[model samples]
Target: MNKLISVVAVVVGTAAALPASAQITSGSIAQNKAECQAQFRVSDLNGDNFLTPREISLFRGSMPTELSGREVIHRQDFISACYATLPQDD
Candidate 1:
């Protein structure tokens, strides 16, 4: 189920960001996922991949504009979706 969600997020994000004919290279995807992981790891504060309630609160405090503000992010699940959906620099 999580895998499916991740796939859908990737498809949606990619389609929203890229053209149908535009090829998404593996390196690009890997790089994007790495970046997302790094950012999340930093935001996690306690080094847990999952965001605690406090961590989530603080994250929303700082970035108060995203879906993370509205939903809890399990350590594993959001990483999967974000790495799949976000761009390399994101």
Candidate 2:
């Protein structure tokens, strides 16, 4: 029907006008290192250079399954694992 066609057109138009969702991708090693360091700094509530299991839980709301049973994690390792767990945009 014409009304149905008009509704479909409007929906399509609105979707086209909206900004695209951000694409998540792995960055270069240097970029990953920097990002990890920044994240570590922000999450390090006690100002220690390392992240304890408790700190990680607080930072991410829950410990990543990949880090389960681990007692401590370095910044670089945490970042790499976290990035690996991210769903690919494609």
Tens digit of lDDT per residue, candidate 1, span 4-87?
586456544543454333433322332355555544544455554667776566445322233454455666765666655655
Clashing pairs in 2: none
lDDT per residue for candidate 2 within 13-52, as digits (tens), equals 5434433432111231213334444444445545556678
TM-score of each: 0.44, 0.44
Q: What is the C-alpha lDDT of each candidate?
A: 0.50, 0.51
- Runs of candidate 2 with Cα error greater than 4 angstroms are 1-39, 57-60
Query: Which runs of model 1 end up more than 4 angstroms from their true locations?
Result: 1-31, 61-72, 87-90
TM-score of 1: 0.44
